[model samples]
Target: MREMVFEILTPREIEAKSMETITKELGGRTWPEPEFSIVKRCIHTSADFDYADNLCFSEDAAKIGVEALKNGADIVTDTKMAAAGINKNKLTSLGGEVHCYISDPDVVEEAKSRGCTRSTVCMERGAKLGKPTIFVIGNAPTALIELHRLINEEGLRPALIVGVPVGFVNVVESKELIMTDDMPYIVAKGRKGGSNIGAAIINAMLYTMGR
Candidate 1:
C-alpha cells in the first residue's frame, strides 16, 4: 500500500487573514491580561454556529484533542504512530484546518498517500501574546538557560517560540519548559526530538484543529 501526499502550505501567506480575534485569544491564554477577559456577544438571531470548523484526526488522537481543548489548549500536537495512527471517520466530522507539520515533506506526503497518516495541519495561529522568542541547545541545562532568557527578556508574558532540534539532545529541556516553565504562550518544537524530530513535534501541534 502507498501513502497519501501531505499538502504543504507555507506559513508566509497566513499573516493576511482576519486573525485579529484568534491572535488576541491566543495571547490572552498565555498572558493573564485583563483585556482578554472581555467577552463579545454576537446576537445571531438567525445565524447558527457550530463546531464544524475544527479539523479531525484519529479516534484516540481526536479523543485526546477534545480533552486538550477542554484542558485549555488552543492547539493539539501529535505524531502519527506508524501506518494508521489516526482515524478518518471522525475526521469527516471536522472542518476548519488540520495542521500536520513534518520535518521532511517527502515522508509526510508518502504517509498521507498510503493512508498511513491521513492528517492535516490545522492552519490556525494562536493569538500572539508577544514576539517570537528563541530557544537554543537541546539538553536540559541549555533549555533551562534559554527559558531563563525568555523570562528575563519578556517576563513570562505571552510568547511564540519555535521548539526545533528536539530529541535526546534537548527535548528534556524543551519538555521541561513546556510542561513546567512560566512562559505563557504557544511553542512549536521541530519534528521529533531528533532527526526529523522538529517536524514530529510540529506535526503533533498541527493536527490540533482549533475549535
Candidate 2:
C-alpha cells in the first residue's frame, strides 16, 4: 500500500511557494516590473500559466492604472461577485469605491425598456459617474461593447478598462475592440477570463501601490 503524505504549510507559506514555483517554471521568460506583478497574480489566482501569455496591456497601462488608483479612481464591475472579490479595504483607504450596478432597479428597468442587456445599461450608468473610474467587465460582452460605443460616440474615457470577459460569444471581439481603442487598458486577449481574473488584476494593482 502506498502511504499518504501531507505537506503542512500555512496559507502565506503556500502562496509564497506557489509564486516561487511559477517563477521557476517560467524559465528564462521575464516580465517588466508592474506587469510582472499583474501576470504573477493572474497566474496565482487561476493556476493557469496562460495568463502570462494572454494578458495584454496598452502602452503604460500598468502605470496608468496604478496612478488612477492612487488618485482615487472608483471601480465599476459588471458583477457583484467581482466587486466582492476586490480588496475593498485597500481601495477605500485609497479614497476609491467599488460598484456593481447590474442588479439596480433602474438599470433593470432601463434595459428592459430598451430591449438591451442590463450590462449595457450598467456601463451607461458607470459612465455617468463623472469621476475617474475604471471599468472591469469580466462577465458580459455587452458591457464591453457599450463601453466601446460610449468611448467612440459619447466620448466616455475611463481611467482603465479591464476587458476580460469569458465566453464564446462576443467576448473575444469585445476585447479586440478595447485593445484597438487608444485607452489605457489591461485585457486578456482570448475567451479565457472570468470575474476572478478581473478581481485579481485589480488586487494586483492595489498591492503594487503598497496598499
Candidate 3:
C-alpha cells in the first residue's frame, strides 16, 4: 500500500473552496435568487447536496425572515446546540437574540408532569414570549407539532418557522403540517435535518443580511 498524504487547510480557505465547488456543480441551474443563495449555504454547511431537492420555502419566507431580523426579532430553537451554533455576533448586530429553553428546569418539570417532551413545552413557552419571533425546530418533531397547535388553536403567530427536525418518527408529518399553515416557513422535506441544519438555515439568513 502507498503511504497516505494529508494536507491541512484554514477554515476560511476550506469554506471558500466549498462555495466554489457548489457554484460550479450547480452548472447554470437557475434557483430562485436570494433564497437559493441561503439554500446553497445550508448545503455547504451539511455537505448534503440533497438539500437542493429537499428544502422547501414558503413564498415569503426569506423576505419575512430578513425583515424580522432587521427589525429586531427574537429567535427560539428547540435545542441548545442549535442556539449555540447560530452566529451570535451577526444576530446581535441585527438586534436579535437566540433562545433555547429545552433544558430549563421549569421546562423539564412541565414535560414530566404533562407526559410530553421538553421540546413541546419549550415551544409553547416561546410562542407566548411575543411576536416577530423565529422558531428553529431541528431536532424534535414534537416541537414542530406544538408550534402548529399554537398557531392554529392558540393563535400564536410567529415571524417565521424553520422546521427541519430530522427523524423517522413524525418528522415528515410535522413538516407537512407546517407547509399547510398560512405562515412563512423554511422546511426540509422528508427526514433529513438536525440541530446543525437548523442553525445553518438561520445563519444563512444572517449572513445574507450582514453582507
Candidate 4:
C-alpha cells in the first residue's frame, strides 16, 4: 500500500481551513451576505455544494431571522437532533432558547388521538407559545403543512420558518406550500436537507449576529 499522509490540525484550524477551501471552490459565485453565510455553513456541514444553489430564501428572510434572534425569539425544531446541534450558549446569550417537543407526552398523545404525526402536534404546541418564534423543521413534512395551516387559518405568524426536511414523501410539496405564503422563510427547494441543515442555518444567523 502507498504511504498515507494526513495533516494534523486543531479543531478550530480544521474548521477554518475547511471554510477557506469551500470559499475557494465556490469560485465566482457571489452570494450576498447573510444568505452567503447560511449557504456556506450548510455546505460545510454536509460537504455538498448543492446547498449553495438549493437554498431558497424569502425576501429579507435572513435579516428578519437575525433580528428575531437578537430580540430573544425562541426557536422550535421538529427534531431533537436539530435542537441539540444549535449552539445553546450562543443562543442563550442572545436571550433565546431552542425547543423540540416531538417527544413530549402531550404531543404524542395528541397525535395518537388525532391520527396525525407527532411533528404535526408539535407545531400546534409551538404555535400556542404565543411568543416570537422561529420554527426550524428538518425531518417532518407534516410539520410544515400544519405550520402553513396555522399561519393561514389561525393567524400564527412565526418570526421565521426554516423548512428543510429531507425525504421523498411530501417534502417538496411542504416546502412549496410554505413558500406560497408571504411568511419569512429559508427553505431547501428540493428534498436535500436534514436536521443538521436546519441547525446550521440557525447557527449561521446567530454567528452573523455576533452571538
Instruction: Return the TM-score for each candidate structure.
Output: 0.26, 0.95, 0.93, 0.96
Point out the higher-scoring one by TM-score: 1 or 2.
2
lDDT of 4 by residue, 46-122 (tens): 99999988999999999999999999999999999999999999999989988899998988898999999999989
> Which regions of candidate 4 are displaced past 4 Å?
1-5
Best by lDDT: 4
Q: In candidate 4, which residue pairs clash?
A: none
> Worst ten-residue run, lDDT, model 2?
25-34
* lDDT of the structure predicted as candidate 4: 0.94
lDDT pick, better of 3 and 4: 4
* Candidate models: Cα lDDT each: 0.30, 0.92, 0.88, 0.94
lDDT of 1 by residue, 55-169 (tens): 1111233233333333433221233321122233333344212223333476457656765431221111112222222221122233334444545664543222223333455
Model 4 clash tally, residue pairs: 0
lDDT string, candidate 2, 116-186, tens digits = 99999999989999999999998999999999999999999999999989999988999998888888999
CA lDDT for candidate 1: 0.30
TM-score top scorer:
4
All models, RMSD in angstroms:
18.1, 1.7, 2.1, 1.5
- The superposed Cα distance between candidate 1 and the true structure at residue 34, in angstroms, equals 27
